[model samples]
Target: MENGTMPSYFYFTLFKDFVHMRYLILILTLTVYLAILLFNVIILFVVFKERSLHEPMYIRISCLSVNDLYGSAGFFPRLMVDLLFDTNTISRTACFVQIFTIYTFAVWEYTILTLMAYDRYVAICNPLKYHKIMNSKVTALYMALASLYAVFSMGLAIFFSARLPLCGTDIARLHCSNWSVVRLSCGNSTLNNNIIGFFVSATTVFLPAFFILYTYVRILIICQKISKEFRGKALQTCIPHIISFVNYSIASFCDIALSRYDSDKFKFVALFFSVGFLVIPPFLNPLIYGLNLPEIRKNIACLFQRSKVGHFPK
Candidate 1:
């Protein structure tokens, strides 16, 4: 150690705390990660292969699945590696990349959910104009815009964070994030970085969140005046999305709230809560949405049956 100063790379202590249970946790973590990957891929394949499922609504669902996959990809590989080794350190460059990937995935998710809510609103509230409102070209455009905006928003945060001079490099968790890296900077730079980070979150996160809630509320108000059959259809379409939305929102809140409060009394809270957001959505979205939607489920059944037929030739 030079001058007893911090290193250029940051070390994580997330697994050290659970050394006795590391193997079990690793096994469980791998299982969950695999499940998430498999299910999301199945959803993507089903939607891609099924012609009937090519409608705008299912396209948005597929995009949501893609978002889950992207988010999981940003974390799981790195996490699994950390679990397999004693060293839990990440270089500054790699940390910033992870921050970009995970944050963009998160922001993209919020945007897509907002987009989906808007799609549903248009479809139900103005059924006659669903075609005009969510046309293929328009849906594609929205998805592209969501992705672009997410990257842009996250890029700004990472750029500002990179400008700060590091005074320490001891990140205290299972993974790296913008805040973790920013916290290492000294003095006024730290405050300015935090202000930028908070601004980005407000613009990219809370506003979209507000729009999602507003759209759903409007949908609910409109539902009250619609026919029972139409309301039923709307509910069926929305419930799965709503469940994922709530799951993600809760996990994100837990992570943000508990991140700075890492007292002895709250040991493991930050690690679990921070990682929970990444784990829950990817695994949960496919199971909930795939089964709940009839066409995708039917396509999945057909795919398996075809595999069976091919395997056992008469």
Candidate 2:
């Protein structure tokens, strides 16, 4: 708790309530985690195995599945361990790693979604040029750039956070976060934590959001002028992306609100917001895309049929 000294570990004060329902909570989260893994793996296998799904849009969807797996890995494993063993302490190194993984996952989610929006725009707006513009090399470059940007932005934020001299060892939430650690700093962290943090958040979250909005508006305008059947097809393709974006935005807002406001008076609501950010997106992305997209649904059906046929008694 000293200004010049740092704590070796952070104790999550929120886990005190888990003592009574630890087993039940563990079972539920484990089930959800297993489902997340299964759903996303199915999507990835379908996309990769089916050469027809090698297009940019499906590639972006696959990236989302991979990111969901990555983000879930950062949260569920540690959470289950804490619940199972009745431990709330996390080593400083492990805490920061979790923050990086979770934060980067958030950044990648938006970036990948933004890329998907762009792919949809080009497809709907300039159908003839879609393949030319979003070729394999271009898609790879977009992903690489997004990944590097997420790393640099989140890395800078984490680096600044890791250097702060801590005044406390207790985090109020179930997990460690950059803002939570910033709040524990003994000195003013406004410049690095808030100012630069705001810039990072804007680029990773807000800017991409605005860009997606812009693309959708343009697509809408284009759709209006096109034939009704074409318009319906275009909108149908965009429906899943729009749903995913809105769902993620709400979840992200809950997390931000939970971090910025004092929610001690509403512990249940606070807990919902805290865990929902990690849980909802990974749990839903695969289902949203899988069920909505005809190709994915067809491919998945074929996969299961093949499995059934292979196992049939000859």
Clashes of each: 0, 0
How does candidate 1 score on lDDT? 0.82
Instruction: Return the lDDT, model 1, position 66.
Output: 88
- TM-score per candidate, chains pooled: 0.93, 0.96
lDDT of 2 by residue, 97-202 (tens): 9999999999999999999999999999999999899998998998899899999999999998998888888887887789998888886654668887899999
TM-score of 1: 0.93
lDDT by residue for model 1 (181-257), tens:
77777666767777877888898779988888888999999999989998998999988878988988998888887
CA shift of 136, model 1, Å: 1.9
Q: What lDDT is reached at residue 228 by model 2? A: 99
User: Which 10-residue window of candidate 2 scores lowest in summed lDDT?
Assistant: 305-314
Deviating ranges (above 4 Å) for candidate 2: 1-4, 311-314
